[model samples]
Target: MYKIAVIGLGYVGLPLAHAFASKYEVVGFDIAEWRIEELRKGIDRTLELSEAQVNEAIANKMLFTNKLEEISTRQQLNPKKRISDNVYHSYQIFFEYKESYYPNSNKPNNQ
Candidate 1:
């Protein structure tokens, strides 16, 4: 079983994580504790996914967390294997320029 870690559970990352959860073990990591709690409660405030979709991902055994340590443990599961051995996707790069897009907001650019 392949384990996938998605290091941003925003619009792009959340949907991507849910899609991957259907076929692989998925760990959806976000910096926001609120976001983690929302997902765990089957809520997707971003609206990229419906509550049912979030629940389905949970039912599929997807893990959502706000802790980097949790993701680190998953990556370290196969220490001998390189990072490429597992599926790792990160949408955080887009967040770097979020300020420019939002022009004062810290939220990600959904458009």
Candidate 2:
């Protein structure tokens, strides 16, 4: 299992981190102190996460921090080394879905 670090806890980062946490060890990082505080209390102001989800994340050892120094210290001591692997990592997922509907119902008169 690889260690993962997710930066920014906005609409994008939060979900990504949650998905990663399901499999690998994940660290979600953000610079906002208030955001960190909200996360600590199992509240997502963005409505991206329910209180239960946030609490579960916390119970699972997913860390949330505002101080860079503390984050660094914790990273160094992280036996899983998940934070190091995620420092500059990027996670992208592309899903292809086909729609059966078509727009512009008017037919062109080619005749």
Candidate 3:
């Protein structure tokens, strides 16, 4: 079974870690202490995941931590990064590209 480590736990990492945990061992790393605390308590302030969903993921061994040292250790043990392609762009552009196949997603919607 593949071991996975996800960095950053915003909308992207949380879900990705959860999905990976269904098949592989997964650890989610985030710099934000509050975010990790919330996740540990089965709360997702981003509203992407319900409490039950988070709890289920946790039950399956999907874990969240705010320790950079732990993340570095995991990285040395298993080198990998799981960031969303959309994270590189603004939400508007990301959503546009996600919805349509047009090459020029940057064009004004009115055009």
Identify the candidate with maximal lDDT: 1
Pairs in clash, predicted candidate 3: none
> Against the hidden reference, what TM-scores do the models get?
0.66, 0.59, 0.62
- The runs of at least 3 residues in candidate 1 whose Cα sits more than 4 Å from the true structure, single-residue gaps closed, are 74-111
Q: Which candidate do you rate higher for TM-score, 1 or 3?
A: 1
**How do all the candidates rank in terms of TM-score, highest first?**
1, 3, 2
The better candidate by TM-score, 1 or 2, is 1
Model 3 Cα lDDT, one tens digit per residue, 1-111: 226889888789888888887888788987566688889999988888889989988999887886544544433442345333234335447557665875544333444
Q: How many backbone clashes does candidate 2 have?
A: 1
lDDT comparison, 1 vs 3, better candidate:
1
The TM-score of candidate 1 is 0.66
TM-score between model 3 and native:
0.62
Candidate 1 lDDT (Cα, whole model)?
A: 0.78
